[model samples]
Target: MSFISIKNVWKYYDDNLVLERLNLDVEQGEFVSMVGASGCGKSTFLNMLLGRELPTKGTIVLDGETLKDEPNADRGIVFQKYSVFPHLTVLQNVMIADEFSSAKVLGWTFGNNKKLIKEKALEFIQAVGLTPAVAKYPHELSGGMQQRLAIAQALMKAPKVLLLDEPFGALDPGIRNDMHELIHDVWQKNKLTIFMVTHDIKEGFELGSRLWVFDKLRDDPQAPNAYGAQVTFDLPLAERVNKNNVNEIIEKVSRN
Candidate 1:
């Protein structure tokens, strides 16, 4: 069975339809990447998966149960911008996840398991290559280091599913390359189910085991906003296809 099932979903903003009849089945531990033209409902789909938005029609299921439509420890997300708190040090940023989540679930105080959580935070921080910056505040770090801290923060709960939205888009090409490697290792080590949304076709194809191209199937120049997008192309990189062929296929299908 699919770990994440999105069945016949549609999204509407008042009279405007953003997504129409979308369906997908994402297996556990699969790394899926998505690409689409801007305003093609890519972010909307991610938000729905994150439980930040509800679909206008149809249902989404996770682990054979209907989605809770609320944020929790089951899923985590990282974005392109500053994802850490400027006022907190890196260790505090990581530790806060344990602090809040435990409080919510166990009615716990910081005194409970303080040493264990700190060690886990530090371990994850070091894993992300941010050990030296443990005591530093977010504002004092470089863009790359700040993003690393964000990643550690997101993984604090050991969520089963990880969602990334243009996570390295703001970094330099060199730094972005480093992040790509980091995330690849993190995914393998944790066996995480990941879904990333990227505008860079190469990066999307390079990172994902499976690629999902979202684009409008029909276009009306006279009424551009009337139609919506779907998963026009779903391909597995493990198949017998080269990068050039994959790129050509994505380019061909992404046209509105």
Candidate 2:
């Protein structure tokens, strides 16, 4: 069975319809890069996947179970903006996940549990190239460093799925390239299933084994919000392709 499944999914916010007719099946360990025009329900889809938002209709299933209408350790998310605790050191930020799981009542772990959490946090921090700054606060780190810290924090739970919403969109070109390499390494090493939403078409093709384009197929000039976005294009990127084919896909996305 597919690791994750979306069947006839639709989302609405009161009178506004945001997404409609989404049906997909994804296997474990697949990296799916999602692209769409602004306000085309890309972030909304990610939120649904994260369990922060429930579908107004239909259902999302993960690991053969229907998704609960709340976030859980099975999934982790990183956004474009840095999501870090300003007062918490890098190590502490990552350790919080373990602490929450181990010491829910106290909000902190002690003794041998604390030691083990610290060691595990250190390993993840090192994995994201943040070991040297383990003692630093979020404000002390640069944007890229902060993002790396966020990724490390998210991975602390050892989630089966990772959701990235424009995680590298704010970085400089060089820093973005570095982050790309870092994320690729992290995904491969962890054998994670990743769903990333990006505006960069080239980055989508470069990083994902599969790509999805979301767009509204039906439009109403009289009532603009009457219709909603859907997955207009789905492509497999595992095969080698020349520049022309890539350009064609780019054009197709742009035209819609």
Candidate 3:
């Protein structure tokens, strides 16, 4: 069985159907990217995987068990907006994640293990190339640096699946490229399963080992929602890594 299985899922808002019979399977240690225009149910799908939103129909299973209604350590999410606490230092941000984990396993007094928690937080911060910024607050860092901190915080939890929702969307091109390289390196080092939603076709091809495209048509009023969408294509990561093949896939998605 796949590490993650999303079987025949459907989502609706009031009477509007956002997703119809959507199904996906992600293997262990795979990097998959979901690419489509805005409001095509990309984020909706990620939320379902994270168990933040339940499907109106069908099931989402991970590691042979159904997901709970609340978030868990098994899944970590990084969003376009920085979720760092403004009042906390970089070290504090990551250490707090450890504390949360410890609290779940131990008790609420995880803050007492200051030395051990600090060491773990520093380890993840250094892994993400943010050693020097550990003492700084979120406001003191650049946009890219803040995003890196977010990534570090997420990784500190050692989640089974990492969900990135347009993490580099707000960064400049140069910084975005650098962040992409960093993410690729992290994925290789940890062999973590990753799922990202992106609108940039180039970035999707660059980072994804497998790509899923969603095409939505608005012209059909008879459709359940304003957006009548379909899962148009699925391709291997190797094909996308090649420049020519990447362009071909981009063209194909564009035409859809």
Candidate 4:
């Protein structure tokens, strides 16, 4: 079996069918991006992979096991909005995440274990080029830096899968590009499996080793009011053309 598999998955909200018969297989250590317009079920899919939401009809498997009731430490999530504790310094933010992942509640109690967590947190902070800002609180940093801190907190857990839900969407273009570069570097260094949901088409093409487009269709009988969305295309990064060809591909897919 693939490292992560979604077999004929279907999702619904009350009577609205959001996704239908979606199947995907993600290899270990691969970076995949899911892209579409807003309310296209990208976040829902990410939640499913994180075990926060169950598919209405089908199954999702991670590392050969089915998703459980609660999210495990094996998967790390970074959302667009900064979820860091404003009261905590950058170092504290990361250290707390490590402690929680390690199942240690005494994160504030200074000791050998706490020191080790501190060291690990610092290591990740430096990895994301935030060592100098580690002493500052989230309020003291710029928006981009806060996002970087959030990324560091997620990576500190050493999760087997990293799920990013438009983590850089709120940043300016320059900062967003920088975050993308940082994400690329971190993925290369750690070979972590990533499943990202983004609306930026360029970002999706740039970061994804494989790309999946979720498109809604009204032709299906099962989906009339809220037609079940379909997986229109899946392609490797190498095969995907640049901006010049992307429009053509999109146009072709839309016509179908």
What C-alpha lDDT do the candidate models reach, one value each? 0.87, 0.93, 0.86, 0.85
lDDT of 1 by residue, 171-211 (tens): 99999999999999998899999999999888887888888
Instruction: Compute each candidate's TM-score over C-alphas.
Output: 0.93, 0.97, 0.93, 0.91
Better of 1 and 2 by TM-score: 2
Instruction: Give the per-residue lDDT digits (tens) of candidate 4, residues 83-174.
Output: 89999999999999667656656445466877898888899999999999989999999999998998898898789999999999899999
RMSD of each: 2.2, 1.2, 2.3, 2.3
Query: Looking at model 1, which ten-residue stretch has the lowest summed lDDT?
Result: 103-112
Q: Which candidate is the best by TM-score?
A: 2
Better of 1 and 4 by TM-score: 1
Q: Per-residue lDDT of 128-224 in model 2, one digit per residue for the tens?
A: 9998999999999999999999999999999999999999999999999999999999989999999999999999988898999999999999988
Q: Count clashes in each candidate, considering only residues at least 3 apart in sequence or on different chains.
A: 0, 0, 1, 0
Residue 54, model 1, lDDT: 90
Segments in model 4 whose C-alpha atoms lie over 4 Å from true places: 101-107, 219-226, 239-247, 250-256
- Lowest lDDT 10-mer window, candidate 3? 103-112
Per-residue lDDT, model 4, residue 217, is 59
